[model samples]
Target: MEDHANSRHKKTVQPVAKARQEVYVLRDLKEYLGESLLIIFSVLLALVLTEFINKQHEKSQTKELLNNIKEELKKNKQAEQEQYVYQQGILKRIDSVLRDPGLQKKVLTDGTFHLDYLAPEGVSLHDLSRVAWQVAQSHDITPKLEFKLVEMLTDIYDQQARIDKIEDKEAAVFLNYESRKPENIRETLILMRDNYHGWAFDRAPALIKKYDAAIKEIDRDL
Candidate 1:
């Protein structure tokens, strides 16, 4: 009976020791998990800070680039304004010549402006065409503008044809004159060709392309 009691006590003690060991192991595992969690959170926080700093740096760079672009655009706009003013001055001078009584009667009324003023010297056909185009553009060309351009082109063509005949028939007349006259005619012809291309075609697409981006940006801003 004493031996049986000793055996039962030994069995109970073994279970108690096993439970104690399990409790110790659980405590150790909880500590390990807590340490792991802390490490993970710290790493995540550092990564978030790094990303925020990088984003801020990128935004600053973008703003700087935008400012530089704005400065360049401002300079270009000023230059364009100066050039436009100069061009207007030249047009005014041409208009004054055209308005003269003799010139008006011979060129404007008689429909010989291209021959008397433009084809002769000092004035250029390209300049004339550009002025006309600009005038039409400023006025926002419609059907009326189109009619004017067509009429202008036709009159200019007729005058040029007449001038070409005169050149072929009386080469000596041109040769005897100051070289400046013929040179002017040559330059005028080149200018006229470019004007024809621009007004009749070519330049419209370029203008459209120029405005397209600006319009889209405006729309985005809106």
Candidate 2:
């Protein structure tokens, strides 16, 4: 009887010990799962915070670029206006020569000419304030700018390039005219007069109008 009682007690104690072991395993599993979830949450939060910061930085950079570009446009517009006025004066001078046949005769007899009447002093053959544009292009920021602004900027720059080329050609022609002999003076004066008239009346005024439009747009946007 005593041996049977001992066997029953051992069986009961073994089952109790096994149940406690299973409970401990479940508690450890729960803690591990909690830790894993916390780690995932922390990583996700960091990623989101980093993205937000990057976006803010980009916004600030883009705004600064726009402001710089706007300032440059204003300067270019002013330059265009001044250039237009100067070219108009040149055109008037050319017209005076064209109307007076005696002026051509005088040039031929004198064997001398004033090249200043063709191209003035302040007019440049290139866009001087293109640094802002160069920076924007190098930074690849066109896509960030307003569409209309980009279009106007592109058009204005292209017109400037065309004007520069024309100015260079006109300069070369004038230089050649100056080097010519007395017999060729009249023909050279006529060519120079016609070139100046065409550029001053047509090309220069058109470019000035474009500059005005661009300036207005930039002012409105800014």
Candidate 3:
């Protein structure tokens, strides 16, 4: 009977030990899962923080670049306005000679008559500086700017470049004239007339509009 009692006690003790081992295994599993979750949360938080910092940095850079661009534009506008005034005055003088019958008679009848009133292309040269813009483009900061602002900048600069090329061509053609002969004079005057027609009607208005539009857009951002 004592031996049977001893066997029964051993059975109960074995089950209790097994139960304790199971409890320890479950506790270890819970600790491991909690630690893994904590690691994942930390990594996600770090990634999110890094992204936010990058965005704010880009925003500051965009604002600084825009300010530089605005100042450049303002200077260009002033220079362009001055050129416009001088060229308009020159155009008036040229028209006075071309339109008046008396001046036409003087040009046709006089064999040695000199015309000093021809408008020089130098007076119409516009100020174009793209250093700030070039920097923004080269460094890839332009993409960080608002889409509308980027579009406006592209249009303005592209038009300015086109106008510069066209004006250079016009100047080259007019400046190649080496003779003061009446026929050469008349031909050059006609060329000037055509060039100025485009300038006064289209190019000048477009430049003023572009500058004003860009300034307005920048002001909204600032």
Candidate 4:
């Protein structure tokens, strides 16, 4: 009878010990899982914060580029305005010569024809600046700007390039030229920026209109 009682006690105690062991193992697993999740959450938060900071920095740099371009445009506009007036003066003088028969005959017949016109200056060019725009493009900041704004910038620069080409076409005539011949002088005078449609002059109303429109758009954006 004692032996049977001892066997029953042993069976009850063994089950109780096994149950406690299982509970302890489950608690350890929960603790491990909690730590892993916390670590993952922390790493994700850091990555998100780093990305946000980088975006902000890039946005600020793009803005600075636009403002620099705006200032540059303002200077170029002024330079073009002055160039237009000077070139118009030369064109009007040439027109006066064109209407005069005596002057035309003298220009046709005379070399060394003692021109009464004093200090016939060479072709006047617009000092337009593309530095700021070039820098922005090189840095790839233009993609961040509004699409319409980029188009406007391209148009203005293209117009500037056209004007430069006109000036360059006639540059050979006046580059260190020392001829006092009346025929040559008259030809030079004729080609010295007849009008915006011709070469070297920016007096065309259309060109100024474009500049004004660009300035207005930039102002609105700012």
Candidate 5:
């Protein structure tokens, strides 16, 4: 009877010991799962933070580019206005010459015509600023710019190019006239005056209006 009691006690204690071992194993598994979850969460958090930082940096860069472009456009508009004034003055001179037959006779006979009155030496063809546009293009910032802003810039530059070309042609005519004989000078002056009037009066003002609208839009956006 003593031996049998001892054996029964041993069996109960063995089952208890096995249950404790299983509990320890379950606790270890829980700890390992928690550690894995924490690692995953940390990596995800890091990736999200990096992405947000990159986006903020890009936005700042884009805004800076837009501001620079706005400044450039302002300068261009001022230049255009000055050019308009210069051209208008030339047109007035041409009108005075055309209206006075006496002045025409004197110019034809003396060959003492002033080409400066036709094309001012100080005024350049499209004296507009392009540094900002050039930098933006070189740095691939156009893609980041708003679609409408890009379109407006393109239009303004296209008009500038056209104006420059016309000015170049006028300059060429003046240079050719300068080297011509006195008898041929009158006709050349007439041609130069007509060309100047056409571009200055008709085309330039339209381009200036476009510039005004575009600048206003840029200001609003900024």
Candidate 6:
């Protein structure tokens, strides 16, 4: 009778132990699922923050480049305005020199021939001067003279070549020059400048001297 009772009690205890094991396994599964979800959320949040930072940095770089371009454009416009002003001053001075009766007579009859192309037409010197100042901040009479000098130099250089056959000794000296390009004829000009008094016996060199002065002024200002 006692053995039978003992067996019955063991059977009841075995089912209870099995139920406890099932409850513990379910609790552990729930904890593992919660931990996995938390890890995934953290990874996604970090990716979003990194993306936001990258986009902000790109936007800043783009803005900086645009600002730089604007500054460059502004500087270029200002420089152009200044150049226009200087050219206007030069035009005014040229018109004045072109109009003076005495100067015109000297230009034509004296055979110095500086204003051969500048005709007596268009606006007066005063008006042009005003216009020039309105356009540019500075007056520069040098460019007008520089343009004329370039033409005169070209003519003078041509004359030298023509005289080569007539004066072989002088031509030989010219040929031996380091560079005889028309542009390099400033060397010959300096020689003439040094011996101006002796050379003036033949032709009035006022135009040439004025041309030289204009070039010097331009160089100094520019």
What's the count of clashing pairs in each model shown? 0, 0, 0, 0, 0, 1
lDDT of 5 by residue, 1-222 (tens): 999988878844443455434344446788999999999999999999999999899888777877888888888888888877877777676677667766555445544455655445532535667788788788788787678878988888877766666567666765574635565655666776777666454677787788788887777766
Across 1-222, the per-residue lDDT of candidate 6 in tens digits comes to 999988878844454455444444446777989999999999999999999998787556544433333343334334334433433443454455445555434433422333222313211111101222222213232243345534543443333233222223323333444424443344532332232222221122332343344344434433
Candidate 4: Cα lDDT at 179? 35
- How well does each candidate superpose onto the true structure, as a TM-score? 0.37, 0.70, 0.70, 0.69, 0.70, 0.29
- Each prediction's whole-model lDDT (CA): 0.41, 0.67, 0.69, 0.67, 0.71, 0.39
Predicted candidate 4 versus true structure: per-residue lDDT over 1-222, tens digit per residue: 999988878844453455434344446877999999999999999999999999998878877887888888888888878777766776676677667757655544434433334114545445678999999899897668777888888988888777766556655544425434544665655654343346446434556677778777777666
Top candidate by lDDT: 5
Candidate 6 has a TM-score of 0.29
Candidate 1 C-alpha lDDT tens digits along 1-222: 999988878844443454434344446888999999999999999999999998787556544433333343334334334433443444444455444545434433322234334344322222211333334334433342235433443343333333233333323322333312532444333343343343322332333233334333323322
Misplaced by over 4 Å in model 1 are 1-27, 89-222
What residue runs in model 4 are displaced by over 4 Å at the alpha carbon? 1-27, 101-121, 173-196, 200-204
RMSD of each: 17.7, 9.0, 10.5, 9.9, 9.9, 20.8
lDDT of 6 at 216: 49
Model 3 TM-score (2 dp): 0.70
Off by over 4 Å in 2: 1-27, 105-113, 117-128, 177-179, 193-201, 212-222
- 1-222 in candidate 3: lDDT tens per residue? 999988878844443444434344446788999999999999999999999999898888878888889988888777667767766776676677676756654544434433344444553556578898998787797667778888988887876666556456556544564433555655655666666666442566677777888888988886
Output the better candidate (3/4) by TM-score.
3
Superposed Cα deviation of residue 108, candidate 6 (Å): 20
Quality of model 5 by C-alpha lDDT? 0.71
